[model samples]
Structures are given as C-alpha cells and as structure tokens.
Target: MEKLELTPPPAILFALEPLRAMADYVASLAPASQPLPQGDGHPVIVFPGLGVSGYATEGLRERLKELNYEVHDWEQGVNQWPDTEFDGFLDLLSEQLKRIHSQNGRPISLIGWSLGGVYARELAKTHPKLVRQAITLATPFADQPNSTHAGWLFTLLNGGVSPMDEALLRRLSIDPAVPCTSVYSPSDGVVGWAGCVGTESEYHRNIEVDNVSHWGMLHNPEVLRVVARLLAEHRRGTFRTLLDTCVTKLL
Candidate 1:
C-alpha cells in the first residue's frame, strides 16, 4: 500500500499526471448498462468536485438518470475556488434544498463529489428535512487539512488556514447525524488519505477503495455500483447500512 502524502510535489504537471491516468482508468471500467426506473422518483442533485468541469461529470449524471433518478447538476459552473469567494454558498444551497423539497414534496438525496461533498453536508446540516441521504466521493471534512498541491499552495498563498486546529476543525467539520457516507482511497494521488476519514461514530461510514486515485473515484464503476445500490436501498425505505443502526424510512 502506498502511503498517503501530506506534501504535494513541486511540479504541477507531475502531480496532475496521476489524476489523468486515474480518470482514464475509471472511464475504461464503465458499466455496460445502467437501467433507470420507470416512474417519478425523488430528486437527486449531483455535485462535482472543485476545479472539475461539467464535461467531467456528464457521464456520471447520465448514469444516475439511467437508474431513474431525477438528477440535477449543481450548475455553479466550474468549482474553481469556493473557499476564497465564500459567495453565500450556504445561502444558495439552502435555497436549492427548499426548492427541491417544494418541487418533489420530499427530501432530496445528494451525491456530491470532492468539495461538492462539503456543500452537500452543509445542506444536510442546514436543512436536514430536505436531504434524505448524502454521499461524498473524496470530499474532506472542512476541518481537516487538504493535501493536494493546489491545496498547499492555496494555504500558503492565503496566509494561514491550517487544517489541524482542533477548535477550527470542530467548527468546520460535518456532523455524522445526517446519514453520510464517505468514499476514499489510500492510493489517492490527491488529498491526504487521512483527511478522508468520516467523523468517528455509527452515523457516518468511511469506505476505503484500493489503488483508486482521488479523481478516479468520480467515475469508477464499483463506486457507481455502491452508489446505485445505496440509492435503491433508500428508495425501498431501507437506507441504513449494516454498519449504522439508525434507520429512518421515508417513502
């Protein structure tokens, strides 16, 4: 097993090369068929990670739609730098959740990738009634320090937002009460592997995949399978994993 690195390589190209390979590998493992259900279903909002473009996630959204999920892309354009802008993102998220609740007449399920996962968790925190289930792929707790080359660079550039302050972390980290699942990999070429762990408790789940890079999990077939299964389980009113005892059925 490759050890996760907190320090990013100096070369930008080198750091990103592994990500490209991972993306290609994930693309190769695409499932042959993703069947959609035949009727109206709960709304599912898909949030892609930071710096990711719409093109990167089009396939994933299509797959969700195939599975009959009413998928909505978090159309905030490219997720370049939300931390710096802080653009009332929480407010926008609140509005979106309210709209989804009103439109669907129920809570919405969220599948957020990377930083988008942070947004998804915040939604659950602010409007728990509007979120049925929240799943995050490679999204770190706000309190944890990120380990990407860019993450370090941004921290250096921004003076100091250390990822290891206990008080600060407690303030920023997501609570496990929102039925959250975090998917991560030890071999992730991006983000500190340790930062991927969910809050220590029964309500949160931390799924570790082997050898998959951070970017790769976005489109990895097995990851998609787990996501689809979880969504289906939620639909059947049996969403809790065996690992978590809290079961709330809403149909």
Candidate 2:
C-alpha cells in the first residue's frame, strides 16, 4: 500500500457538507428502478460515523428497508470510540451480530460509514461466519494509523487515546475473510482516498464514485444504487452478473 500525505489544507473541504447534503437531496429525486432490487430480507446492521448517532444513517436504513431487507440501527447512540473502550464496543457489536444471526438463521450484512466502516471490517475479520458481507463508505483503513484528516478531532474526542495503534492498523490493512466492497471517492475531504482502496481479490472489490463528499456518502444516490445492486447480487448469487453490471455502470 502506498503511504498517503495528510495535508490539512485540502481537508478543509469537509466544511462543504451542507452543500453536499443539498446535492444529495436533489439526486434522491431522480427515479430509480421501481421497487429497487429486492433482497432475501436477511438482517442488515448499519453503523454510523465517529461521534455520530445511528439517526445519522436513517436515510440509508430506510432505503435498505425499501429493498425488503431487515435493516437495523446500531442502537448504541453516538459512537464515542474509546469512551466505551474498544473491546466493549466490539463485544456489543458481536452480541448484536449473534442475536441477528440466530433470529434470521443466516449471516447478516454490515454497512458502515467512516469510522463505523472500520468496526465493520474488524468484526468481519473476527467472525467471518456471522457476516454475509461487509460494505464500507470512504473508510481509511489502508493508510498508516493516525494519518487522517480528522486525526486532531478524533484525538481530542477520545482524550488522546488513538484507536488506530500500530497493531490494529496492521490488522485493518489485511482483507477481511468475507465478501467486502469499499465504496469511496477521490473527492472525499475527510479521509485520504488512497486509504479507502480495498485489495482486489475473489471477495474484495473497490467502487469509486465521482464528486462525492465524505459525509454525503450515506445519502448519495449513486452510492446507494450500487449498494442495493450489490446486496441483490449477494442474495441471488449472481457474482458474474454483478461484475459485468458494475463495470458497465462505473464506466
């Protein structure tokens, strides 16, 4: 993996979140396929970005529900990271995964945004059998620890306890055992885009979107469309079709 320079000047673009939100709202008005792509109603849990509450992902949760998937919120309120201790947070997530798996009698999919994406990837690594797939939005797992635009804020919020230590960063760089899709944008102003790239493999793929804001990823219509398509493919076991369709759409 290539090292990314975390220059603060470019990161100031994150302040344009309001503009991105407006654009996302307009994009959402465009018509997509009716009924979208139906899923098998398998359970899905969405995790919010750092310092954000589950409500931040309500739009995505609703969209997933429209696809007939059993979507769920993290229900852990704001993601305060080390406040709950990393191990405790993982335990909570693990418990939720187990409960959902037991109830649905099948593995669950995880869709995480930003820091939440980190958690999703780690969870899948720890318990691949419990996860059907893992999808991340603009997550910076490939770069060295602490090399993020939000490092300052993250440090202040966590009381100087960095979540991305050397060991954890090394673990995050490896591909998870389950099917994984990383949805990212070069225009993202929060995390370095290079760090968001997933190592391509039989089960790992990266989808790059154009002109998408880091914060707008959860509500970006194009991103949502690809996510819905990926979920549908997973449900239907259409890997070849997915590859062809993604190539066409992305081109």
Candidate 3:
C-alpha cells in the first residue's frame, strides 16, 4: 500500500489535474465508455464541491440518469465558503429527500463530492432512515482543513476560520449508520487521499481508483460505473474489491 499522505499532493501531480480533467471529458465521450450495473430507479441527490455549482456536476448527473436513477443536482448555487444560505439549503434538502422517499417508497441515495460529502454524512447521521446509502468522491472529511491545497482558498473566501472548526472535522470522520462508500485516489491533486478514506466495515467501504485526480472525479467514467454498481445493488456489499472484479475486468 502507498503511504497515507498527510500533506498536500506534490506539485507535479497537482499540475496534472487540469490535464487529467480534460482527458476525462474526452474519455466520457469516447465510444469505449459504457455504463455498467444499471441503477434501480432510486432517487439520488448529488452535491457539488467547493467553489463550484451544480453545473459542474452536470456530466456526472447525466451519467447517473442514464443508468436509470432519478438524479438531481443540489441546485444550491455556487458552493461558497461562509455559506449564508446553508440552513436554508438543508431545509430544502430535507424536504426533497422526504418527498422523493415518500413518493417512491424507497430510501434515497446520496452522492457528494468534496465538501459536499461532509453534508451528506452529517445529513445521513440525522436522517438515516431516509437514506439508503452514501458515496463520497474525493471528499477529505476526515482530514484537517490544512491538509488540502484549497484550504487557503476557503480561508480567503471566508476571511478566517475559528479553532472550533476542528470539532466539525472530527465529526466528519464519524461513519454514517447506513451503508457508505468513500472513493479515493492515491495521486489526488487537491485533498490528501488518506483523509478521504473512511474507516471500512461491513456497511462502509473505501475504494481506490488510481487514475482519478481530484478535479477529474466528477465526470470520470469509471467513477460513474462504480457508483452505478453500488446503487444497483441497493445495499451494502463487498465493494472494496468491486473495482478489481467489476470495473477493471469489464474494461
């Protein structure tokens, strides 16, 4: 196993992020890419990363939709620090999840990216009954803020953060009661990959997709296929080996 890196990624890997992001786009459009393990029409909510909006997740959401899930983006505007409307966002999120679950009579699935993954875990803690499972993409919820290269940008956007922020960081590391998955890449260019990994158990699994960059996690086709497989199962599974047996072998 590679070292569980505590510091930000090296400059070379960080520098490759934008280029890998571009290649992800090309790969998504290539005829070779295909959806595996089709979804079961469960409702899913996708949360965006920091400094981005739902638009950034359009491709990912579209892929989920193609897999037969009822997918919806957060629609929470740009993900800004000092989010003044977060309480309101949570309120609306609760309404949507409850409504979807009531209508469909199935627990909703959550797919969150980066900072948004924090929201998903906390939300599931409070409403585990409404959530079937959760999947986090490049989310460093278990790490200190400074472990990420983008920490400074968060501080700059919010002026300064308080020491109490560590309390939330600890809370983020707590696994949700329902099934959960944390997808990580060793060469992640933004957040430290180690912190993105949650403690693994029967209901919670950490998976490694080595080719992904933090910036490329959203639209990378393999990531989509992984999510599709988990959602199709509609329950917890031996997903740690899913990439090796399902994703790689299919390719």
Candidate 4:
C-alpha cells in the first residue's frame, strides 16, 4: 500500500492539543479500560519530546510505575538540540542507559514521546544488549522531517538541516534491534500520524488509538493501557497486533 504524504496537521485541529490534554486529565482520573498486564519490574526509561521537560512525562512514568516497572525520566532539564552541549545529549543518554543496565543486570526498555522517541530508537539500535524493547508515542520517524507544523522550528534551532540532520533522520527511520511498538492516533494535532507509525514487522508494530492528540499521547489513559500491555508482553513473547489492547477496543 502506498503511504500517505506527510503534512502538518491542520491549524484548527492542532490548536486542540490543550483540549485533548484536558480530556486526558479527566479520563485518567477514572479507570475505563479493562484489566491491564502488570510489569515484571524491569527498568524503563521515558524520554520527553522536543522543547519539553521531564515534567511533561510524569503522568506516563507514574502509569508505568503502577504496572510495576522501574520508570525513570530523562534528567536533562528541558529537551533541546541533541548536539547542544556537554558532548551532546545522546552521549549523556548512552551513559545513563549503561548505568541503568549495569545496576539492573537486565536490559532496559526505552519509551519516548515524540522527539524523545527518536532518542529511544537510536539508543536501542546503538545498544541493543542494554535494551529489552522500545516504544514511541506520536513520533514522526519517517524521512520527511519537515512534515510537521513545528518542523520549521526545529530547522531554525538546528541552524538549518546539515549532513548530520540527514544522517540522523536516516537512522531514526530504521527499526531497532529489540521489540518496538509505536502508539499513535490519526487525530494527532502535532506531527502527522503517517510518520508516527514505523514499519510493522514481527518485532516492530503499531497501535492506533482514537481521540489522542499529539500532546495527549503522554497523559492519555488509553495510551497507558497500551504501554502496560506491551511491557507485560516482554516476558511472554514478542509484541504483536493481537495483544488484546483496549486502545482499539475502548477507544
């Protein structure tokens, strides 16, 4: 099947992120989904999206904690350019992954939202032995980096795309060595959903939910259930489409 062309979401729709976020807050207060799988107490690191701080992912980390996974937030204050300072954030990320992997004595799971997903995928590829699986939320990992409304902002920050930008985009599109899951919604108000769901295979899969705007992917209750299922699937086997997800069923 031919993939849809990538484009920024409509301005009217994109403006609803705050509304969706509000809805997520209300929905998360009351559990609506059926029983979700509990985690095996493995470590999972969640990376925040571009231009945001770890506070944005606090709800997501809390939900994962309820599943019994050791969840940690990216310590870098506010997310900025990957190559910003201190030998770059990726290096910092690598060190953190190594420390966590060493202390836990088990591979860790990487979950990233939007730009954070870019980090999760890259780290998994670079250090598969240290990673059990990877999950991305509302991330545009496809080749067309300029497809989102905020794409230009990124370009401006990076001082225009260079060879490094091209290389990173190429790497982001590639699937990680470990099991990978992408949770996205067609109604996402930020990045286009087409690029959010990477290529699906035995180890790589996509879960599409309803009513989750790009910003809401972090706090959306349905998204939490999806993550819980994927994390629980680690012990049984690889993640697949037929995971009894409440995402499609309830959403």
Q: State how far residue 227 of model 1 sits from its true place (Å).
A: 0.9
Pairs with backbone N, CA or C atoms under 3 Å apart (clashes), candidate 3: none
Model 4 per-residue lDDT tens digits across residues 228-249: 7677765423546544453455
Stretches of model 2 off by over 4 angstroms after superposition? 1-12, 33-35, 235-245, 249-251
**Predicted candidate 2 versus true structure: per-residue lDDT over 140-242, tens digit per residue:** 8786545567777787786776666777777787878777889988878778778888667767888888888888898788888878877776542323346
Model 4 accuracy (lDDT, Cα): 0.80
The local lDDT score (0 to 100) that residue 63 gets in candidate 1 is 77
Candidate 4 has its poorest 10 consecutive residues by lDDT at 241-250
**TM-scores of all predicted structures:** 0.76, 0.89, 0.88, 0.89
Per-residue lDDT of 83 in model 4: 58
Q: Model 4, 236: alpha-carbon shift in Å?
A: 7.7
lDDT per residue for candidate 1 within 7-110, as digits (tens), equals 43235434664666567465646554654233246788888876675667787788788778888888677765455434376786677778877987977888
Q: CA lDDT, every prediction?
A: 0.65, 0.79, 0.78, 0.80
lDDT sort, best first: 4, 2, 3, 1
Point out the higher-scoring one by lDDT: 1 or 3: 3
Clashes by residue pair, model 2: none
Model 3 per-residue lDDT at 1:
31
Any runs in candidate 4 off by more than 4 Å, and if so which? 84-88, 159-164, 236-251
